[model samples]
Target chain A: MKNLALSLLALLTLAALLLGVAGCAKEAKEEKRSESKTATETPPVKKETIILATTTSTKDTGLLDVLIPAFEKETGIKVKTVAVGTGEAIKMGERGEADVLLVHAKKTEEKFMAGGYGETRRAVMHNDFVLVGPSSDPAGVKGLKSANEAFQKIADSASNFASRNDESGTHKKEFGIWEALIIKPEGGWYIKTGSGMAATLRVANEKQAYTLTDRGTWLVQKPNLQLELMVEKDKPLSNPYSVITLNPAKFENSRVKFEAGKRFADWIVSADAQKMINDFGKDKYPEPLFTGDSTLTTSK
Target chain B: MDLIYLGFKQAFIMIFKGDRLVFEIALRSLIVSGTAVAISMIIGISLGLTIALARFPGRRVLLSLVNTGMGLPPTAVGLFVALLLARRGLFGFAELLYTKQAMIVAQTVIATPIVAGLTVAAVQNLNPKLRLQSLALGATRAQMLWTLIKEAKLPMLAAVMAGFGGVISEVGAVMMVGGNVTGDTQVLTTAVVEYVGKGNFPVAIALSLILLTLIFLVNFVLTQVQQRETSSWPKRISK
Candidate 1:
C-alpha cells in the first residue's frame, strides 16, 4: 500500500513535468481567469503554434527547456522547437519553413534580413565562445588573448584540432579565425566530426585535441568533458543570439504563424523573459549561461 | 564502461519513478512505427502479390526498383522527403513539414520496399503448382491468392517485423521531417540523440536501452505468433 502511494505521487509529479515538454502547461492562476472568461458569451479561441528553429548550442545548454515553458504558460501559445546548426536554422527561416529563429550567426542573420526574409530581428542574449583543449595543452596555446594567434599557434604546432565541420555557428567562427590568419586548415591534424558541440567535445576529450565551443554549452558539460578553457574572452569569440520572425506578409499563404511568432519575438526581449534568460544556469553552473543583453556585442 | 553502467542506473531510476517523458516517447515511437508498418504491409503485400502472380511489361524494372529501395540509405530518403515537403516544395500547401504525419510518410516510404521485396521472395519460394492445384480444386482467383498468401504467412510476418524494426530504429529521416520537436515528434530514437547532444551519456544510453527493450519485446511477440504450433501444447507434449 505504501509503495502504491509513493508511485502515485511520483506519477503526479512526472505528469506535471511532462506538461512542460508538451509546451502546453498553464499556471493555476490562468485557469481561474479562463474559467471566468468562459462564463460569458464567448467565441472559441484558436491556440496558436509556432515552430522555433534554433542552434544546437542554445538548445543543448537546456535554456529553452525552461524558458519556452515559461513563455507558453504566460501567453498560452504552443511552441515547437527544432535545434540544428545555425546555418540550417537560418536556411529554414529563409525558406519560410520556420516561423521564428533563435540563432547566433550575426552576419548571416543580417544577410537574411537584407534578403527580406525577416519581419523583425531583436537581440536576445549574449555569450562568448572559448577555445577548449585537453589539459595537457598539446599546442601550448593556453591563455592566448587573441583567437587568431591561438589558431596560428595550434596550426604551427601541428596539433590535433577537432572540428565540427557541420556549418554550425561555432564552426563558422573557427573558420573565420583561420581565414583571418590566411590558413586553409586541411591536414591530418584537423579532425572533422560533423556533429554537435557535445560530440565534438567528446572527440576532443578522447583525442586530447582542441576545439572551439560556446561558453554556455561548455559550462553545462564541464563535469563530463576533460577539456579546459584554453583561450577565452577574445574579442572575436563573443556570440550574440537574436530572435527573428519570418516576414509573414512575404509568406502570406504559407504556414508561418505570424502573430504568435511576433509575440515570442516581442516578449523574449521583454523584462520578464529577459530576466528568465539572465537567471538561467546560475544555480547549477558557476555562472549564468547567457546575459540577457540586447546591445549586440561587437565581435565576429 | 562507466557510461554504460550509469545509463543502466538512469534507466532503472526512470522506470521505477514512472517517468512520463520516457513513457511518452516510447508510446509515440510505437504509434509512429506501428502505423507506418501497417500501411506499408497493405501496400507492399498487394504490390508483391500482383507482381509475383502476374506478368507485366515493366515487372522486371519494378522488381529491381523494389530491391534497390530495400538497400537505400535512410538519410538520403529523408532529404528527398524534406525537399518535397518544404514550404517551397511541390506539396508546400499542405504544411506537413516538421509534423508527426510527415514522419509517418517518410517511414512508410522507407519500409514499403522492404516489405514488398521480401514478400516477392516469400511468394516465389512457394511451389508454383500450389496455385495450379488451388485452381484445379475450383478455387476462385481471389480465393487462390488468399491461399497463396496464407502459405507465405510466416515469411510475411518476418517482413512486418523487419519493417517495424527499420522504421523504429531510424533517427535520420524522423529527425529530418519531425525535427525532434520535444514532446510532439520526439520518439525514443531521437530522444537519445537529444540527450547525447547535452553530453548526458547516461540518459542517452538509458533512452537507447529503453528503445532496444521496446524493439525486443515487439519482436518477441511477433516471434511467438509466427512460430505458434498448430496442435495444442498439451497434446504435443503427450506425443
Candidate 2:
C-alpha cells in the first residue's frame, strides 16, 4: 500500500511539472501578444523582434554581428537572424516563414518574386566566388582566367573535387559552371559533401582537392585551411546578394511583419548600411568580403 | 515558455491533421533507428555472449573496451563514420555518404557497444550453477547457452530498450551523415534541428514532442514485457 502511494505521488509530481511548463508558456505568449498590440499605440511600449533569414556566408564572415547590433541600436527593433544556405533561406521567404531574406541566389530570388511571395526586392551587396585547392595544385588550375576552364581542367585530370551538393547558392553556381562546360562530372573524382561552404572547404582541404567557395567564407576560413586560391577573376563567379520582404498577402496565416520587414529592406541599402558593408573585413582581410551595391547606392 | 506550449499544441494539431511531412519524418525516424537497433542486437548479443562465456586472454581488456564504447559520443562516432565513408577514405568507392544507410551505420556504431555492454552485464549476473545444471541434463553447449539467456530475459529486454533509446534520440550523427535531405533522409530529430535553425520554434517544438512521445511509447511496450505479471499495482490497489 505504501509503495503504491509512493508511485502515485511520483506520477503526480511529474504531472505538476508538465503543467507548470505549459502554464508558463501560455503566460509568455499572452505577454508577447499584448506587447505587440501596445507597440503600435506608443513609441516604446515594448520591444519588437523581426525575423531575418539570410545565407550562412554573411554570418560566417561575421558581417551580421556588426550590422545587426548597429541596426538594432538605431531602430530599436531586435533582429532575430536565421543563417542558412541561400536556397533554404529563399524557400523560407517563399513560405512566409521569415519577415525578410538576405540571400545570394538571383535566379531563385526572381522565381520567388515571380511567384508573388515577396513584396519588394533590392540589391544590397555583391561578392565573388573563388576556386581554392591544395597548395600542391595537382589539377594545375592555377592562372586559369575562366572558372569553367578551371572546372574542365579538374575534370580532365580526374583530380578530386569536393562539391557542396547541399543546393546552397555556391552549389548552384558550381552546377551552372558545370552545365556550361558540358562536362558530366561523375565517378570517383566528383565527391559531394552535402554540407555548408566552410565544411566543404574543410573536406577539400582534407582530401587535397579543389572546391568553389564564396570569397567571404574563404577569407574567414583561410587562416585555418592549408588550401590556397587557385582560380579567380572570372565573370561567372560574381555573386550578388539581395534583400526581399515576404508578401503578407500571400500568407495570411503566417506571422509576417510587413511594416517592419519593409523598414529593414530600406535600412539595409541606406548610406550607413552601405558604408558598413564597404568597411566590413577591412582590418582582418586584405580585401573587403563584400562590396556595396554601387548602382543602388547611387540611385538612393 | 510560450514556445513549449505552442510546440505541444502544434504537435497535437499536426498529428490530428495528418501532416504529410510530419508522418514521413516520423516513419523515416522509426525505420532508420529500428533497423540500426536490429543490427546492433544481432552483433551485440552474439559478441556479448562470447565475451561473457569465454575465459580467453585479454578478456578484461575487451570488457573495458566495451564499457568505454558504451559512452562514445554520438558526434565523434559521426565524424569517424564520415571520414571512413568520405570519397578519399577506404570505403569511399561504395559512395555510401549522405544516405540513410550512412545514418544507420553511424547509429549502429553508437548503439552496438551499449547493447553489448549491457548484455554482458545481464548474462554475467546469472547463476554460474545454472550452466552446469543444464549441461548435466544432457543439454548441448548451444542449448545451455540458450537456457542461460532465457534466465536473464528481463535484462536482455532492458538491453534492447537501452539500445533503441540510444539510437532513436541521437541527432548529431544522423544530421552529419544523412544530410537531413527533405523527404529523403530526414528524421524527426534532424527535422527538429532544421526547423529550429529556420526559427520555426513551434514546428521544432512539435517535432520534439513527437520524438519524446515516440521514445516513451517504445519504452512503455518494453516495460510491459519486462514487468509482465510482476507489476505491484494490481495487488496494492486490491489490498
Candidate 3:
C-alpha cells in the first residue's frame, strides 16, 4: 500500500513537471507572437502574392505596410515583402526570387542592371540621410553645413561613431562621404554594427554614438529614441530609392510577375503615392518623410 | 563544380582562421543544444523512471503516447513552434521566437520523448533482484530507490547522450525558432543548410563533417558506457 502511494505521488509529480515545462514553452511562443504584432495583419490572398525585395528601413518605418494594402486594394495583388540589406535585396533580384527590387544603392543597382538581371529601374523617391548623435553633440558636428564637413569633424574629433558595416545603402553612402572627404575612419572611433537600420540605430542610441540614418526611419523612430539629427540638408546626404524589375530578358520565370511588379513601381511614384509619402509622420515628425523627385539624377 | 570547389576552399579557410562569427555561431549551437539536453534529460529521466515503476490506470496508453512522440518529425515540430512563436500565435506574448531560448525549447520538446521512452525501457530492463535484495537487507524505500537509480545509470546516460545527438544535429527546429540570424542564433546545422542552399558547398561540407563527427563520438561513448555497465552487473540471480 505504501509503495502504491509513493508511486502515485511520483506519477503526479512527473505529470506536473512535464505539464509545467510544456506550459512555459507554450507561453514563450505566445509572448513572442504578441510582441511581434502578428495578429493585426491579415494573411496575403493566395495566387495574388507578389514578392518585393527591399531595404529594411522601408519596413521598419511601417511605410511598406501602409503602401502595400493600398496597392493590394486597388490592384488585388497582395505583396510579400522580403526586407534585407540593399546588397541582399539586389541578390534576390538576380536570383529571380523577388518579382521586384526597391533599393537605394545606385552603383549596386546599376551593376544589377548592367549584369542584365534588372530592367526598367524606376526612380521612386528621395530622402536625405541625417547624421544623428547625442543631443550634447560631443563631436561638435551638430551645425555642420555639409555631410563631408560633419564626417571630417567626426573623424578629426575622434568621437565615437557606429557604422552599419553590413554593406547597406546607408553604409555605402557613409563610405562614399568618407572617401570624398579623404578621411580613413580608423582607430577606436568607428564601431561596426553588422545589423539592419533599426538595430543599428538602437545600438547607436544605446552607445550614444553618432551614426547616419535615413530621415524617414529616424523621424518614425525619433520619439522612442534619445538621439538628435545632427547633420541634414546636404547634397551629399541625399538618398534616393529606386525600384527595378528583374529583367525578364535574363530570367524567363521572372516574366510572370513582371507586370505586377511594374504596377507597384508605377504606383509608388504616382502623385497620390508621393503625397502619402510626403504626409507620412507629419503629425508626429512634423516633417515630410520623403520627397518624390523621380527626375533627380543619382551621383555616379 | 568549380564554384563548389572554390566555396569549399573558402569555407575551410574561414573555419581554420577561427572566424569570430563562425565560432560565435558554433558556441550558440552548443549552448542551445546543451540546454536542450539538460532539460530533456531531467524531465524525461524522471518521467520514464516513474512510468517504469508506477502502477497506474492507463499506463499502457501513456507509454504508447510517449513512444509516438519519439518519432515526431523535426520539420513538423519546427512548423508548430514557428506558428506558436510567431507574432500571430497565442504564445507570442513571450516574444521567444527567433531567439536562442526558443530554439532550445523547440529542441527540448522534440528530444524529451526520445529520452523518456528510451529511459523507460532501460529502467524496465534492470534486474528486479537488486531492489528485492535492498529491501531484504532492511534498506528504507528511499535507499532502495537510490540503488535502483544507481544500477540504471548506464542506460540513463545512454538515453541522455542519444537525446543530445537528436537535438544537436536537428536543423529545422533550430532554423525556424532561431530565424538563422547571423552571429546570434545560428547553429552549425542551420549554417550548413544556408551554405548549401547558397550553393556554397565547402562550408556546408565542413559544417556537416563536424556535426557528423560529433554525433558519432557521442554514440560511440554511449555504447562504451552501456557496455561497461552491462559487464559490471552480476549475471547470476540478479536477473
Candidate 4:
C-alpha cells in the first residue's frame, strides 16, 4: 500500500513537472508575442513571421538566402521559408499554412488557382530545362534538335533514364514530355529515384542515365556530375517560376498579414529584386541561372 | 573514394576552425534532442515502474504497444506529428506547427516509448527475490520500490542515452515538424540532407562528422555517469 502511494506521488510529480514546463512554454510565447505587438507600434517595428513555401531549387541555388533577408529588412517581415518540391509547396499553400508560394509547375499552379487556393500567380523568372546523359551518348541523343526527339530516341533504344519520381516541378515536366510523345516509360531501364534534383542528377550520373534537369541546378552541380548536356534549347523545355499568394478571401483570414504576403509577391518582381536575380550566379556560372524579363509585377 | 577523402578533409578543417554555422546547428540539435530525452525520462520511467511493479489490467497490452512504438519509423512518426499539429488537427489552436516545440513533441513521442520499454525490461530483469526480500525485512512497499529503482539505475540511464541517440540522429520528424528553416529550426541532420540535396557532399559529410562527434561526446559523458559505482548491491546480489 505504501509503495502504491509512493509511486502515485512520483507519477503526480512527473505530471506536474510536465504541465509546468508546458505552461512555461506557453507563457514565454505569449510574452514574446505581446512584446512584438507592442514593439510594432514603436518606430523600430518588430518583425512578424510569415511562412514562404518555395521550391528546393530556389533554396539550393542560394537565392532565397539573399532575397529573404533583403525583403525582411525592407518590410520588417521575417520569412520562414519551407523549401520543398513544387507539389508539396503548393500543398502547403493549399492548406493555408503558407502565406506565399514560389514554384515552377505551370499546370499545377493553374489548377491550384482555379481551385481558389491562390489569389494570383506572377511569372518572376525563366530558366530552360536540359536533358543530361552520359557523354558516350548511348542513344546518340546528343545535339538533338528537340527535347521530344531526344526523349523518343532514348525511349526507342531503351537507354537508362533517371526520373525524379517525387512529383516535383521538374519531375512533372519530364512526364509531360513523355505524355506528349505517348510514351509510358517503364522497365528496369527507367530508374525512379524519389529524390531532389541534385540527388537525382547524382544517381543519373552514376547510372549513366538520361534525366531532365533545370539549367540552374545543372550548371551548379555539373562540376561533380559526369553527365554531359544531351538536349537543350527546346521550345517545350522553357521553365518559368511564379510566385503566388494564399487566397485570404477564400480562407477568410482577412487580416493585415495578407497585405504582407502581397508585399512579398510585389517585392520579388520589383526592379531591385529582379536586378538581384539577374546578377545572381554571374561570377560562378557562365550564364545566370534565371532571367528576369517579366514586365508585369503580379495580378489576380 | 576520392569524394570520401575530400569529405573527411573538409570535416577536419571545419572542426579545427570551429565553423560558426556548423557549431550553431550542432547546438540546436543538442538542445532540442536533449530536452526531449529529459522529458521522456520522467514519464517513461514512471510508467515503466508502475507496469513492472503493479498488477494492472491491460498492462501486457500497454507493454506490447510500447515495444511496437520502439521501432516506429521516423517518417511515420513525422507524418503523425505533422497531422496532429497541423492547423486542422486537435491541437491546432496552439499554432505550434512547424516550430522547434513541435519537433520536441514528436521526438518525445518517439523517445518515450523506447525509454518506457527499456525501463520495463530493466526493472523486470531485477531479481524478484530482491522485492520479496525487502518486503520481508519489515520494509514498507514504498521503501521496496525505491530500492528496486536504485538497483535499476544503470539500465535506466542507458535508456535515457538510447532515447537521446534516437532523436538526435533522426531527420524526418524534425524536418516535418520544424520546417528545417535555416538558422532557426534546422539541425545537424536536416542540414546534412539539405547539403546532400544540393550535391554538396563534402559539406554534408562534414556536418555528419560533427554530428557523430557530438553524439560521441554526449554518450561518453552519459556512459561515464551510467558506469559510476552508485551501489555494490548488484555485485553482492550476483554472488
TM-score per prediction, in order, is 0.87, 0.53, 0.53, 0.89
Which is the leading candidate under lDDT? 4
Could you tell me the interface RMSD of model 3? 15.6
User: By TM-score, highest first, what's the ranking?
Assistant: 4, 1, 3, 2
Candidate 4: pairs in clash: A3-B142
Higher-scoring candidate on TM-score, 1 or 4: 4
For model 2 the local lDDT of residue B52 reads: 91
Runs in model 3 deviating more than 4 A are A1-46, A253-256, A294-300, B1-239
Candidate 1 has a TM-score of 0.87
Question: Would you list the rank order by lDDT, best first?
Answer: 4, 1, 2, 3
A1-300: candidate 2 lDDT, tens digit per residue: 333433533453354355445545764796566556556654531266566788778876778878987776666565767667888888767755567999988788889888989878888999999999988898898888988888989999999999989878999999989999998789898989987777788789899999999999898877657899999978999999988887778978555677888778888999999999999989978999999894663221
Candidate 3 chain B: 10-residue stretch with minimal lDDT: B193-202
Among these predicted structures, which one has the highest DockQ? 1
> Which consecutive 10 residues in model 4 chain A have the weakest lDDT in total?
A1-10
Global CA lDDT of candidate 3, please? Answer: 0.76
Order the candidate numbers by DockQ, best to worst: 1, 4, 3, 2
lDDT of 3 by residue, B21-104 (tens): 566556556667877877998999988988998889999999998999898898899879877875446685565666778888
Docking class of 3: incorrect
lDDT of 2 by residue, B118-236 (tens): 99998998778889999999999999999988777667666866887888899889876776655457789988866644335566777787789877865765566556535744873
- The positional error of residue A153 in candidate 4, measured at the CA in angstroms, is 0.4
Off by over 4 Å in 2: A1-46, A294-300, B1-239
lDDT tens per residue, model 4, A1-300? 324333533453465456546645865796567556546554223456788888888988888888887877666677889988999989988777788899999999999999988887898998999999999889998998899999999999999999999889999999999999999999999999998899899999999999999999999889888889989998999999999987777888432246678889888998999999999999989999999955855566
Among residues 3 or more apart in sequence or in different chains, the pairs in candidate 2 whose N, CA or C atoms overlap within 3 Å are A25-B1, A25-B2
Q: Write the per-residue lDDT of candidate 3 for residues A167-197, one digit (tens) a residue.
A: 8899999999899888889888798998777
